[model samples]
Target: MPVRGGDLHVGVWEPEGGGPAPPTVLAVHGITASHVGWAELARQLPGVRIVAPDLRGRGRSRDLPAPYGMPTHADDVAAVLDHLGAGPVVVVGHSMGGFVSLVLADRHPDTVSSLVLVDGGMPLLPPPGVAPDEMAGLVLGPAAERLQMTFPSRAAYRDFWREHPALGPGWTDLTTAYVDYDLVGAEPELRPATRVAALGEDIRELVDGDSVQHALDHLRRPATWLVAPRGLMDEVPPLYPDAARDLWTVRYPAVRMVPVEDVNHYTVIMLAEGAAQVRPHVVEALGEAR
Candidate 1:
């Protein structure tokens, strides 16, 4: 789909026997991720159309220019729906994609009927005085570091993720495909496709952007936030910790919070077990949209 800066790359999955016009869901992957992140979710929800896009500066859309912020990403999503001639579909967003979903719902109110936010969308304050530009590298840690890494070969990159504590234990063909798709550049010099500068701009907004805050304050759409118990590295202190969850719950009572057990930030949408848990909520949201 052609949007603002360039032709956006979108991945669509048609349900097993879903003829023309099956219920459609617009999915958005996390920061540093591409449309392939939704592979498992697409498989799990075989009756609905799963449409995911590689946000500008990520995946194949890596060349899409700057001004990479939530509003820009939201507009790109709106353009995708317009290009498809689709109206108000349920939107599911994971990680930074969740933040984009919030702004989309708020900015393009008619574009999203409801939302399923997986491990993102709520506010996450930065450590006091941390520079906005540094937040991505600071918070993301390894996920951020890998963007600058060079792989000797595809297998080397696969090996890196295969050793990941969270993804390795549950590794599947889907993971392999995702890892493969993420690599760009020639062999022996392949690097992940996400642009570091784009990530920094987006992360700055996620950490303390006014758009997210305003979106939450006036959020009227039905939304569900699913949280992972572990962090990106499968560590205990997940992105949205218990206290943060509790505070957000009190602050935005309208957005329901659900806890997904034994999954890290990545696995919550990247693996079968996590997708199984997320399936019902997505179904419910789609059902209610009708």
Candidate 2:
């Protein structure tokens, strides 16, 4: 789809039996992830249309120029909805996409009817003693580190993720397709498509910038936050810790909190079990949207 800078790559999945206009879900992926990450969610909601986009600096849209931040990403998403003539659709965002979704609804209210925030969309203060600039690296860790590494082959990249503590154990064909789609360039020099600069900008915004905070304060749409108990590496203290989750609950009681047990940050969307947990929320949000 044509946006401000260039063409944005959007992956659209129609339900099994086509209808004139299926209920639509706009899925936004994580910081270093592509639209393909939503494969399981798309499959689970076979009756609804899934329209997912590779945000400007990741996936097939990697070359879309920077100025990368949640607001910019929000506008790009708004442009996508405008191009498709799709609006007031259910928006499901995972990780950084959740931040983007917040700003999208805040800035382009007409385009988003409701939100399904999978392990994201809330404010994350920098851990004590960690500088704002260092928070992304410390939190994102391996997911951000791989962008600087090069792989000899697609298989090599798959091997890298296969050994990942969180993603590896729950690996599936759906996850494999997502991993493959993130690779760009020729053999021996192939690298992840996410731009390091874009990652930095987005992380700063989500963790420190005021846009997300403002969005959270002004959020008017019905939203649901699906919490993952484990962190990015399948460790304790997930991204939205219980204390923070509690704080936000008090602030925005309108946004329902749904706990998804036994899944890490990655599995919440990549694996079947996780998608099963998320499917109902998407359906419910769509119902609310209508």
Candidate 3:
């Protein structure tokens, strides 16, 4: 792990072997999620050199001011690109990270030659008449309060994740070691270095989007969308939309939105099977991008 030095420094992980790797794939995790979320995705992607950045105020790059919205994230990403001495790289982002990716392509098209949006990127028509702050509260309340709960020991953390709704059957098996990798104390609690306020700012960006669809329409790079199947039965929060994914034809014309199965919000990229499914698609995109 390396942290670039600057007002907009971001953390990065580069796998070994340097034979002119494919354009670095910048993996930006969703709200509050550290670069760790892409741990499994990165490991399976040895064919390409990839870097996952801790957005502005999240993870180890917590130096930026508040209101780290789409443009802010885009700028931070561009800065990270310049710092790495890499440009025109392909970007792969999940959930809120996808929104930032869209913004990146919109605002800094020269920095990104291609974009892969996993489980996000389209405009969300939140139920009618929902107030902004209330919607924000609904979307980010859990992370704001820190759902990465502390446990008496590492085993307790592993036990709790096995039953966690957001995780899948194999998440525990894959993440148990990764989550505890940086633990320090005797209790060995799982803790993230990401910040909460940064998460709130990210929610503010999503909920406050001036028509996220309009923003996404400006993407100029090659783009692909991988959507996780989501509906009422699997939805957790009571008020969030449970509608089946609608036709995105009105948004991204060149981008394809494909459904990914057997994976939820977490396991989609955090587990081996899910990554295996996506790895080939990404390789295809890399070939196209090149």
lDDT of 3 by residue, 52-112 (tens): 7777776556655665777777778887787778878888888788889888878777888
Candidates in order have lDDT scores of 0.91, 0.90, 0.67
Off by over 4 Å in 1: 127-134
Per-residue alpha-carbon lDDT of candidate 1 for residues 31-147, written as tens digits (9 for 90 to 100): 899999999999999899999999999999999999899999999989999999887999999999999999999999998999999999987755558776666766787887899
Model 2 regions lying over 4 Å from their true place: none
Arranged by TM-score, best first: 2, 1, 3
TM-score of each: 0.96, 0.97, 0.81
Give residue 143's lDDT in candidate 1 (0 to 100). 82
Could you list the CA RMSD of all candidates, in the order they appear?
1.4, 1.1, 3.8
- What's model 1's lDDT at 18? 55
Query: How much is the lDDT of residue 93 in candidate 1?
Result: 96
lDDT of 3 at 282: 77
lDDT, candidate 2, equals 0.90
lDDT computed for candidate 3: 0.67
Q: Which candidate is the best by TM-score?
A: 2
Task: Give one digit per residue, the lDDT tens place, for model 2 in 13-117.
Answer: 998899898898999998889999999988888899899999999988999998889998999989999989999899999998999999999999999899999
